[model samples]
Target: MLKTQFPLASIFFTFSLAAFSSPANARSIAIDEATRLPLVKRAQVWAQPTWIDNTFNFDDLFNPATAPLGSPDEQVLTKGTIDCTYLYEAPNGPVGANPKFKCKTTAQPSLKLKVKYGTENGEVRGEVLGTRLLWALGFFADRNFFLKTTNCFGCSENPVNQKQTDPNSATTPVSFSPSSIERKLAGSEVLKLVPQADGTTKVSQGWGFEELQMVDAPEQLRDREALKLLAVFINHLDNRKANQRLVCLDGSSPQGCTGQTVMMIHDVGSTFGG
Candidate 1:
């Protein structure tokens, strides 16, 4: 009889091997001409998986809501006012269908807010649950929370519809009003930024799935394969670069990170429900 005390280990190893053993299923990754060079260069650093120490404390997995991240009480503190400015990037051309904006508050100075109205609110719930699970599993996930109701201080009158109508429009002067807002709080998921030709820096971008093939480090091969299985287990349908980020844990621009490179799941809203 073939058996072992660690069934989970057996299962994990089996899945990873089945998925990664063959090159027959491999396919070419789509390249973004604008970001190709930058992304390729970045792959040397960001493609490294965030690994736990060989002697890492196993208890941390069960206590994800606590320190090095936050406490359980802090996770539930979701309702608050956020001052925001509209972002011009939209899927519907000129204006956005699902309004997104940059936000700030007294405590959390920087956040990216994605508001989904009507029947799409499930995404918010999925994000909260998905990230919680991923975090507990020791994956790098954004410190995010979901709000049932909040005061969006600088949103337009009808942010979703109105913002899509006029390209030159801007949010009215900052004001507070209670709204049934579904927004994510991106507190510490700072992404690596690449320098632009105009002296500005843009958030480092590329799909997480693409890196599954690109990660060449022998030490990280198992973890990299496991992440592929994890995505399928979570039903993560949206595998775009925008939903995930390659971050520098230590160091600065150009040189990027001198210590650790973290591949973070920036948004898991499309997961579980996918």
Candidate 2:
């Protein structure tokens, strides 16, 4: 009987010690505010004083300078005709892709062309206006223009012999189907070429950088809350990571880009209240 009682007491003591020895809080995870990011919808937005177009005017991001926007870098090609196909896609991309293609033109050598679908969603207008607005405000945005969608004849990598009746004249060989039928890329289609770049651009999706420029990091790249506010102002609801990209000035990949880089906002499809 004494031996059994001693064993029972030992078990109880072991359990008690184990219970008291447990950690006060969950040691599995350590929440660090410094490294964590807030939810997109819950992100904080603050107004800051900014100088636009070399003018010292008291303005916030929501209301940027109305001055005609110009390029901060010499590489930004503001005008061009998109006559080339995308390098990733043949003649044209899958119908699901952003109506992009390739062209052979002397307008500007972006080599790739992106076209807008139609006016129902105003994607072309949205992309054009949104990019222009951002570029005007000094953000790295692509150069887009209102181009003629009728130029897509024989632009498809996989050509077809079938014919479809035109909506207006009831004719064959229509190039404005899946594309904006009645408008230019803006109305029928919006056109833009990939801006030519000499430096290796860091292609990033989320909020981080490879090699941050010391002087401009704090103002232009880091603390990009102003950009968020601007996105909100433009009604860009599709602020997903897929819609954003980054590039390095030295032509290095993100991991190899231990140099200066630029941030770019693309596919502003859901803009102007869409």
**What are the lDDT figures for the candidates, one per model?**
0.45, 0.36
**Per-residue lDDT for 1-274 in model 2, tens only?**
0011123244335323422321100011111222112221122112121333455332322122232233332122222222222123333222433443333222434323444544353665556566655554445555555443434433442223212222342222224322311111110011112223775433223332222222222433333544555666667777664455443334233123333334445557667753
Count of steric clashes across candidates, in order: 0, 28
Instruction: Count backbone clashes in candidate 2.
Output: 28
TM-score of each: 0.54, 0.46
lDDT of 1 by residue, 192-249 (tens): 4467899976555435576656543454445555566677777887777767655444
How well does model 1 score by local distance difference test? 0.45
lDDT for 22 (candidate 2): 15
